[model samples]
Target: VNKEHGAWKCHRCGESGSFPELQRIFGDEPEAAQKEAAARWLVFSNALKVCQDTLLDYPHILKYLRHKRRLDADTIGKYRLGYMDEDFIKQMRAKGYNMNDLREAGLIAEEGNRPTFQGRVIVPYLNRDNIITLRGKKIGGNILQARGVSLGLFGADNVRTHEGDVYICEGEFDTMYLDQLGYPAAGVPGADTFKEEWATWFEGARRIFIVLDADEAGMKGAEKIQGILGNRARIVELPVPEEEDSTDVQEYFIRDGYSLEDFDRLIESYRGTRLFTVEDALVEREELKKAEGLRLGWKDFDHWIHPGILPGQVMVVLAKTGVGKTAWITQVLHNLSEYWIFMDGDHQTQGPGIPILMLSLEQTKAELVERMWRISRLWDPWMTDDHFKLAYRNLRLNDENRIPPEDVRVLIHEFVDDVQMMPKLMVLDYLGYWARSFKGRSRYEQVSDSIMELKALAKEFGVAVIVPHQVSRTGRRGERLELDFARDSGVVEETADFALSLWAPHSKEDRAGGDLGYMERADVRIEILKSRHGGLGRETRMLWAPASLALPAAGERGFKDLIVKEYEWLDRGLLYDDIHKRHRGGGV
Candidate 1:
């Protein structure tokens, strides 16, 4: 009998038993056998029994079991799920099963050799041959810890007959709940850890659904399991509530009272995909030899500038103090309203199409509104009511006033959801105020990450972002400013898809004398320092209307004229006129 005992222990419920008890649950096999099939069955039976009782009372437990234990309903029911009460413990003790043995079997909790699961739900696990081995117990109380004893085979006995579909959850109760809903499922003890043997059971199933608790840890576990299953698995994610951790599907079903249809819908809406190894993806990419062409949008400054402020692309407008960067961005916002109107009219009159979000970290809301009103009156004088809805948010003035990361997340989420088409353009008036760590920082590394995060936010929500930056003092005397003049030149250039530098040319007369005595006139130069798409680096002369704060036609050239001139440069290199004449059968 001692030889027959072998080295068998319940890994699922953390249980241990003597050779006789293992034999009674698994079956009397030869002592010399390499694999004790009976011991596996014994462990599986105990786990199944514990799952059924806990899940029947609290169906939400299914969410937990789906990812933890891998047992299905038919197996759960057949094993006769029950809870161990004081009377049951007394009977077991009468049969010579001491507290020490119960603790070892994980049938009871142990506090210095004392049992805790005196009255608790019982789940038994079985082997492939339908023999019971390990048992788990769900004890009631706010403070009592659950127990699991690993005998052999996680859900072996319950998995006697292979099914077309299998569900994987986090806990035993979750597996039982899924089984009750006419699905085959199993559970793991803990979400963070998984046994390698469980992978084999998933290999044979035609379809495998891994349902995890609606929490970060659960999702991570599901991802880990999906990594093991490869393309053979799909994930069924539970809808996480705003509060509380969702460790079990039964909690979602029973406590939240979600129906089977709702559950199915939730499964259909799972957002995660199986991750492939980098090496594997690289190999596949080489084998496919796929080449995707770029899709270019409008290259015109006016057309592209307003919209190209798109989510993934950052637009940095750098200017010296009092150079009108804020005014330029605000004018851009006003022009965007026209685009919104066009989109709204074309798409079923979506009601005042475009929305704009402005984060004026430097200015108060009242001050921003006043400036907006002054500009709005200039752009649309006939407007009696406020047509453009402006949103203003102020950043922290001091370190103590800084907004928490969670609050920022909430603000962004609310802003995105509240608007109809989401905001067409989001403007951050100044970069310095938006950063929490802006004090004593250069324009490069620290600030660059914050700007990149904002760009990510834009890309995530499909909105355009415009950020204003300050120019360095090094370029004040130069005739023309370059990208390097922008503070933290490297980072600003690297992060932005377009870098627009605004400068007001001072009269030579003012430089000749100590002061021009109010006779000097300044011309605003809009320099396209860097255009990631394509554009000449020439200054577009524009007259700034002080009253309107808008840029009207300066000289005889408009934005369109500048674009035509740039395009002419491209054609000059190609004698396109001769080619066109030949194609038309004309003299070259």
Candidate 2:
């Protein structure tokens, strides 16, 4: 027995059962309710076997199925479709099953013990070897399903083995037709019968085509499926109008004379031009509120750019050479790597801290490793009192040798796939540094292709990518930085979800002068040039601690307190000069 999953199998007899089932069989005698349920299930299975054989005896039932329902012999046999008539109750009694057992299995009425599915076609809902329930449908009439049984998604078991494209239709016949046409499909009992939790069944599917009935109820049901499955779902409307009846998938092909190719073309060409209602916007707003994404731990900056950097967003950090762009990015990376859990007393186990993958294209692997170590050293005082190890254990640095020049994007994808833990945040040292490696007609084309590739990777992997960009030589000498300053990349403003430029007020010449001993500790101004979430032209400052290359935000609560309250003796000279100077209001 597997204790974790509570499943056991007998090697000798080839018998397998759940732990609960084993307990009921051997551990203890079953209760009255359990015994009745077990008896009903056995009766139901026996009745299904008899009904299946009985189907062959009835010529009229077969004629109705073939001529009216358009179902062939093979389709009927594959689904185990059967027939039940007035003779059903007499057959059960001759087999030694009583009226009470038939009533318990929902095959007959409680009052007179009359067959409930008399003169109807039987459709059994099977879960592997056992039948979950049974439904009976009168030709061109209503459907009567088994009582007190959960009728889940039809053909739900088919998805466990199937992959790639899947179709979700409104009825079982529609699903069967699609399956016969070589498409993996499942069906709900009705147009609006799909449950939101069932979306997990299709998670492995490449795409889900929701071919619900083409009506108001069907359209609403399709939209609900799309919302639950996100962008992977596509609602395929039939060619017929909503006002008309029989506008389902089966009718579209059979009655409307549409071929498989025509149906394929219809789905492929469907652009879904349906306008969003106010309810859609409100639903999106609530989802955004729930997934506020990763933060940089700067309260002042986080306030202006609320909800942090969301998933699938590409944020570009830009600065001139020798400026503190990498330092700023390192600090953000360290902040994200630290364990952060919800503090509301509801979900306080751990925070949004996630694994990160760093591609050090601008510097060698050794240099990037040293940089991460130095930042952790400065920040470790706040994380722990341990002297030997660092706290940022989730950072993964890629080897520069294994990554090819032209196949940078492809290699990055492979790297992500090879890792055990997928990184939610990926850091690429700089874009322009590797953009020249990609083959293109011109430099501009290469840079643009590289930018698009990064954006695509972020979207495909659902990771927030941060890429630093170099400033043009001419733009470096300008008074202030702009979006166009990103060297060779004109699409950075348009492609990036957020674009930030970093520069210090003091010139490089000023840092060279002997008077500016505290030049390394200068406040580097970070300006948001573009933000898709709408915080454009906003500015924030980070105090650059040159000793450790840690860019802590100015006036932020934690970092400075950690430095002064705990690590003051460690960096006596630098801490006293920088922290005291800031406390005295001498610096910005």
lDDT of 2: 0.70
Error of 2 at 10 (Å): 56
Against the hidden reference, what TM-scores do the models get? 0.45, 0.46
Q: Give one digit per residue, the lDDT tens place, for model 2 in 1-588.
A: 653222455775434454445666686545975777677778888898888988999999899878766788887887788988788988999889988778777788756866888877888876665776777888888777665455567877666455687889987777777777777888887765576668878878877889998766777667667756877788786877445654988788777879989988887776443479999989967876788577776666776677788878898988887777778777777677653222232212222456788887767777765666666555432322232122455566765632323244334444554655667788887787667656679878877877887887787567888888888854433256888878776777789988888887666666545464352435578888888677788888776665566777777545554433323333354553354334322111
Lowest lDDT 10-residue stretch of candidate 2:
340-349
Which candidate number maximizes TM-score?
Answer: 2
- Every model: Cα RMSD to truth: 17.3, 18.5
Model 1 lDDT tens row, 533-569: 5554855665454433555335523333322332343
Q: Alpha carbon lDDT of residue 463, candidate 1?
A: 61
Residue 257's lDDT in candidate 2 = 77
Q: Over 4 Å off in model 1, which ranges? A: 1-300, 303-311, 338-353, 386-409, 437-443, 477-479, 507-522, 551-588
The Cα local distance difference test for each model comes to 0.53, 0.70
Model 2 misplacement above 4 A: 1-286, 339-352, 381-390, 401-421, 475-478, 517-521, 557-588
TM-score of 1: 0.45
TM-score, cand. 2: 0.46
